[model samples]
Target: MSPLDDEAWEAWSPHELGQRLREATLPWYVAGGWALDIWHGKQTREHEDLEFVVIRNDADHFRAILHELEFFTVKDGTTEYLPPAANLPSDVWQLWGGDMRHGCWRVDMMMEPGTPDLWIYKRDRAIQMARSDAVRVSETGIPYLAPINVMLFKAKHCRKKDQIDFNFLRPRLSLEEKEQLTTWLNELHPGHEWIKKLPIS
Candidate 1:
């Protein structure tokens, strides 16, 4: 069994989790498969961990909070205090117990650049639950994302994994937003095969 029980998830639920970091209200965003679900409006598959994009300045605070949640220093000596057994990428911090393959106990956090101040004004925010009851663990308990922000992120990365996430999220977008994304993609990588090869379903 995983270290996180039902109650633990309650604490980590999107809204509750977000609230925990609200004091700092660090510039964080969702990324990876979970972010794809936010962009698509539905979960295409289970996630292994909760991937977050944070500003580098907030890294220590983020680590401290995870420790409070019982996440030990699995890789304290490595570059960036990684959990060695978790085998994550150099940039990711892997917290124990999440069934990462199916999107269970692992929480992966990373740092990324934020939108410029002028563009930040255009971001959107919404509340969602792991299930559909509008229920959350705390004030910030709901899962949230900036759809356009995630979309732009996928566009720039364009790796196989990124394409897969975009594929899962694409069908959930409005026709206009889809068009805009397509236009953006074209501009980002003119005639890139990703536009034609991704499975819509």
Candidate 2:
């Protein structure tokens, strides 16, 4: 669960947030439910907040672009504002961006492991792909996670929203994408219900 103060936080659209980081040279892509909406080329459902991913190694570059917002480290259900010079724990990957005045979280940033050329799946580092293969850009310049990759992330939870996402994306996946998703699902979550639904090739 996110430790966000709903009333105090103001959400930004993916494009809006992307524009804020236009000067950044590091690779970043929108993740979570919003990514799915971006892939569909329209809003499919209401989103609680927006999320994007940056490589762990590029954290400093990411911070440089979003310097106006206060960054907080979220770990073990507790949230603490990160001092400008403080180092984030190795196990802590999620950072919440807050408004300077009200301290309300507006962006949820996920720090992933990889380089500019490779995208290493955090759950299983063995599962890897070229960074180019893992993300795609919208016509409007918003970059988002590939649908198959996003579905793989959602498979572990399978919450109501996850189910909705799965149902919506299942029919849209290409044969190759479905095969790739199924292979990873079987390797990472052997008995996941989603595997049964994936088309056999």
Per-residue lDDT of model 1, residues 1-201, tens digit only:
224442233214344446566665444555556655654556677554566655444566666665444332224533233442333444444434343334334455554333312222112222112221211122324344545346565666677666677666665666665565566557666776556643333
Distance (Å) between predicted and true CA of 120, model 2?
Answer: 0.6
Error of 2 at 22 (Å): 0.6
- Model 2 scores a C-alpha lDDT of 0.85
Deviating ranges (above 4 Å) for candidate 1: 1-16, 39-42, 69-105, 115-143, 155-164, 194-201
Each prediction's Cα lDDT score? 0.47, 0.85
Candidate 2 off by > 4 Å:
1-8
| Model 1 TM-score relative to the real fold | 0.51
Q: Backbone collision count in every prediction?
A: 15, 0
lDDT of 2 by residue, 1-201 (tens): 234464566768998898898888889999999999999888888887788999997877777688888788878877877765677778889888887665566788899988989988898899899989999999988889999899889988888998999999888889999999999999999999999899866
